[model samples]
Target chain A: MKAWSIEKPGSREVLKQIDVDKPEPQTGELLIKVKAAGINRTDTLTRQNAALKKPYPILGVEVSGVVDSNQSTDSKLNAGTRVCGLVNHGGYGEYVVMRADRAMILPDELSFKEGAAIPEVFLTAYQTIYWLGELKNEEKILIHAAGSGVGTAAIQLAKQLSQATIFATAGKPEKQEMARKLGASVTINYKEESFDERINDVTKGTGVDVILDFVGASYWPMNLASCAADARWVLIGMLGGSEVERVSLSELMRKRIALKGTLLTPRSDEYKASLSREFMQIAMPLFKEKKLQPIIHTVLPFEKLPEAHRIMENDENIGKIIIKMNQ
Target chain B: MKAWSIEKPGSREVLKQIDVDKPEPQTGELLIKVKAAGINRTDTLTRQNAALKKPYPILGVEVSGVVDSNQSTDSKLNAGTRVCGLVNHGGYGEYVVMRADRAMILPDELSFKEGAAIPEVFLTAYQTIYWLGELKNEEKILIHAAGSGVGTAAIQLAKQLSQATIFATAGKPEKQEMARKLGASVTINYKEESFDERINDVTKGTGVDVILDFVGASYWPMNLASCAADARWVLIGMLGGSEVERVSLSELMRKRIALKGTLLTPRSDEYKASLSREFMQIAMPLFKEKKLQPIIHTVLPFEKLPEAHRIMENDENIGKIIIKMNQ
Candidate 1:
């Protein structure tokens, strides 16, 4: 089996295509033949940080593949069934094994590349927006990193499922435009304007009901200022920095804000399986009906994983970047 | 009517007994002949802080009294009915007005002082534990300021309702003992030992599932370190300080903690009414059955309101301090 392994930690130069033994399906698990895998910032961070203790050297968390074998006889999944799901590790390899309950059958309407893009971003967005944020139909939401994969997915879900007013912030004008096209009621180029001031101005000082933040520390004060009373601020990533300089406890209490920090990868298999069931029930139909579409920036061949990492590092992609196996 | 008013802010010396007009019952409201009232830290803070805009000049927030009049015909409350309820303000008076919906019929098993102590502390504890924390049965919880009003209430409720292991922290040895008596599995004198170290030792590094915190900024880092994965840290007050020195977003994300800041006073009448209903349904029965008891530290004459404030300022009390209205 061919896999992208981290030869040395730190930078895209460390990523190398290497041959590895294929994984076998365990009890209640399925062995998958990788068709396509999505590239995420977490993968890049895992590859770059020497201190991060990873279970495997391979770098992928989500993959779309064909079921090669199933260990559990009663499992709905059988050999040759196309599926996409979250993997604990080793998704960068041509062959990987995943828990059967966590995998969802890929709809015929969706391609392998699209399926690869759906699991991580869509599920994360779904979990954060619906489960953590508890987004209501009439509520207003501010999504940071609007051009990123999770950001785009959140926008589409918010638009399709709820009557929420979407506010988005992106680093570049083109990215802001892309966010606007994707369903953001208002898009701000964060480089050009202060999002807090923009939110205050646009909402007439009412502020947003929920905020999906990836940019931490630098945006903490602004995020607090931009939130309405009883607002939920769901933290998914800390792209800007981690150390919050001075958080006013009084302001948080006065505003009655709920700050929830979430990470999907660290959760148990049972939890992910529940999330998979929910996503399949609610989101799969949207994909099949073309109401929701996976936004792909570029699809590179599996061997060109380093190029995909470079694209992500350069922040040149509008949405998800995919790595296609045998392309 | 006679009421205690703050002539000036910043000290208990500013509190003075003054003559005021008795408030008439408004629509869906009750005019009560005040029997007893409970003193809370919020009352003291409102008295001391010149900047905190209060609804009225009165000192107390919760009172036990006889219903003198009921304005709403549909209300279950009637003249001469004994009730304990939350007052917006003016509870430290000969007479007080409260919303009929917010008032609960007092069980004959409890005294006026106990009834006065129950409303604020028990309601706050219930809202924090069950609603905000979403505490599950058999989960471990850490309660700060375990000798205080809400802390004692929480310990009793958690023990009675949910099979939770309660870990408490207080400044004094006697206070720690009181916490243990109330239902805390372990009590740490925070002055002598580091609570985070104690928690780590006791739980064997698993940490607490929920932390009900009143001491804010100073305990921020320690609180984060003391929490288990997916912990809910419900912040009810900021007695220690408001400015958090340095909060690591990464740690919050990695632990997947939910940091919620709550204030019960500023919420709408409808919201508080709903909470009152829930407390009546679930907790009132426990009080009736003598399974849960309100812990009262002392009963001071209503005229000695300043003395009550002084005791609170010195942090000398083990449990709730009540003011007897007509003694």
Candidate 2:
């Protein structure tokens, strides 16, 4: 099996393709012949030794492929079934093991690359928006990195399943338009203008009900400013920095807003499986309904791993970067 | 008219007892003859030039008194009505003007000092538990600084409304006992042991469902560790600071927990009034039924302003501290 292994965490230079023995499916696990995988910001971070514990790290949390083998005959999924599921760190390979319950049957119309891009970001946006964000109809939503994968998924979901008004933020005009096409009510160029001022102006000083943020320190003050009374601030990634600065408790209390930080892995297996199962359930239907579509910025062959990482690190890509495993 | 005024934002030296023109009720407002005022942590923070943009720093936020004058025929209340409500500032005085809708009619059986304490902490805990925390019976709740006025209020309210398994943390044995009497299922002396470890041990590795935290930065790590799967972390204060040295994003996401920093003041007038009106409806009967009582530490003459601030800053007192305008 061909896999990208972190020989030692340092920079993108450390990620090297190496030959490895194929893994076998454990009980209740499905062996999937990896076809495509998505590259995320965290994948870049993991390669740079910025993980909970360094070394022995494989990139990619999202995967799509045909099930090569099934551990149990009683399992609902059988060999040759097209599927997608979240992985611990082993998705960036020719073959990977996925839990049977976490596995979702990929639609016939969807390609492996599209299935690959759906798991990590779609599940994250789904859980954060409905579970943590608790977004409902008529509520105002402020998505910070609206052109990114999670932001794109959230916009489409809020557009199709919920009636909430979506306000998205991006640095460039094209990316902002991408959010608008995905059903964003308004787009704010956070680079050119003050999001807090603009948000207040747009919402008539009522502020937004929920905020989905990726830029950490840079967005904290404005995140507070833009959030509505009893608003929920959901933070998944902090591209700018992690350390939050001093905030005025008076301003916070007045709005009764809550800042909730989140991530999608490092959760127990059961927790991960639940999200994976639901991604297969709720999000799969939406994918089939064409209400949501996975946007791919570039499809790089597994050999061009270094170039993909460089593109992501520079924030040059608007949507997900997919890497197809072809030998 | 007599009142306590802070000529500037600074230490207790700025808190001066001075004669000023009594506040007159304008259209759609009420003039309240303040019998008792509750001093909260916000009051102490305001006096020390700590509140957001503190130039005209008047101290109090919660008060109970008779309606001295009512200029709003739009409201149901008359001039002789007893009421309690929350305000941004300007509460520590002989007469204060409030929007007619903000006032909650006080029960005849409750003393003015207790009523004053009820408005701030009770409303704070009510929102934290019901609206933000969404605490239900049989679920686990951890109230940090469980002996403080808000903590005590949360303890009693959780017992009365939800059958939540309440765990409370206080620095002293006396305070822990007080928390237990207020209906805490278990009381932990945070000074003696690690709260995170205790929380796990008490729940057998499943942490509390909801946490009400005031000691922010110092406890952020433990707060994460103390949360159960899908836990709600609510930050109400940061006496210990606001920054955590290391934040595990993966851990936050895996558990599907929501971390939120919240403040109970500065909400829109309409929002605050709605909360007040809801709380007055739900909790008014509890006070009259003797199910809930304001835990007052001491009532001092308004001239002893410095002592009140000192006691609150030192964190030595139990429950709330009250100051009488006339004694």
Candidate 3:
């Protein structure tokens, strides 16, 4: 099996393609012949940071593939069934092993590239918006990094599930337009305008009911200032920086704001299995009905894994970047 | 009518005895012949901050008294009924006005001083532990300021409602002993030892499930460090300082901790009414059974209101400080 492995820490040059022995499925697990793998910012950071505790040298977290083998006798998935699922590691390989319960049957309506992009982004967006944020119908929401994978997914999910008013922020003009097209009632090019002021204007000073933030510290003040009373701010990533400058505890208390930090990769297998079941039950139908679709910015060959990382690092993609594995 | 008014902000000396026109009960409101008023940190902060937008000069927030008048035609409360309730202001007076719906009929087993201490502390504690923190039976919780009004109330509530293991932090030895007497399985004198280390030692590095924190910035790092995976840290006050020194976004996300900022005074009357109803249903029976009781440090005459504030500022009280009115 050929896989992209982090040869060293700190640069895209560290990613190396090497041949390795194919991994076998463990109990209640399935070996999937990878068709496509999703590229995420987590991969880039994990490769660059020497201090991160990597479980494996391989860098991918999500993949779409065909079931090659099932270890458990009671496994529902049969060989050759198309599936997409999250993996702790080794997704950026010719064959990857994943827990059977976490695997979802990829709908015939979706392509392998689309399936590869769905699990991480959609599940993260769903968990944050519905489970953590508890976004209600008719409430307003602000999605930061609106051009990114989870941001686009959140917009689509919010639109399809509820009558929420969506506000979005992206850096580039084309990305902003894409967000607007996706279902954003207001899209601000954060590079050109203050999102806080824009939110205040659009909401008539009441502010948005929920904010999905990836840019930490740098946007902390703006995020706090742009929240309505009893607003929920869900933090999924720290793209900009980590240490917040100054937080007014009084303001947070007065507004009754809740700040929740979450990540999917570090979650337990049981939690992931439950989330997969929920996503399949609630969101899969929407996908089958074409009410929700994956927003793929670009799909590169598996050999060009470095290129995918470069594109993500430069923030050039409007949505998910996928790497198609060579058959 | 006699009342204590903030003559001008900046010190306890500014709290002055003044004569004011007796307030008539507005529609859906009640006029009470005040019996006792609870002194809280909010009162002290309001008195010190000249910039605070006070609704009225009178500072008290919770009161217990005989219902002198009811303005609503459909009001369940009648004249001469003993009631304890939350007030936006004017509680530190011979006569006070409160929303009829926010008033709870005083339990026969409780005294007026005890009733006055109950509404603010118990409601705040219940909202934090049960509602915000979502504490479960057999889970562990760390309560800071364990000798304060809310802390004492929380200890009692957690003991009666759930089999939660309570860990408390107080500044003084006597306070620590008082916390243990109430229900805390372990009590730490925060001034004498590192709470974070103690928590780690006690939980064997697993950490506590919920943290009820009021000391903001000073305890922020410790709070984050001491929380177990998926823990909820509920913040109700910022007695230590408002601005946090530094926050690690990675630490917060890795732990999946939720930091919630809350205040009871700023909530809408309808919201408080709902909370009141919930408290009555879940906690009132415990009071009747004597399973829960308000811990009053001292009950002084109304003229000694300034002395009560001094005691609160000096952190001299073991539990709630109450000021009683001589009708």
The best candidate by lDDT is 1
- How good is chain A of candidate 2, measured by TM-score? 0.95
Each prediction's whole-model lDDT (CA): 0.90, 0.83, 0.90
Model 3 chain A poorest 10 in a row by lDDT: A50-59
In terms of DockQ, the best-performing candidate is: 1
Residue B82 miss distance in model 1 (angstroms):
2.2
Q: Model 3 over residues A118-187: C-alpha lDDT tens digits? A: 9999999999998899999989999999988999999998888987899999988888888888899999
Order the candidates by TM-score, highest first — what do you get?
A: 1, 3, 2
The alpha-carbon deviation from the true structure for residue B5 of candidate 3, after best TM-score superposition, in angstroms, is 4.6
**What are the TM-scores, per candidate, against the unseen true structure?**
0.95, 0.70, 0.90
TM-score of 1: 0.95
- Tell me which of candidates 1 and 3 scores higher on lDDT: 1
As a TM-score, model 3 comes out at: 0.90
Clashing pairs in 1: none
How would you encode candidate 1's per-residue C-alpha lDDT over B198-246 as one tens digit per residue? 9999999999999999999999988998999999999988889999888
Q: Candidate 1 overall Cα lDDT vs. reference?
A: 0.90
Report DockQ per prediction, comma-separated. 0.84, 0.22, 0.69
Those runs of model 1 whose alpha carbons end farther than 4 Å from true positions after fitting are A49-56, A73-75, B6-10, B19-21, B49-56, B73-75
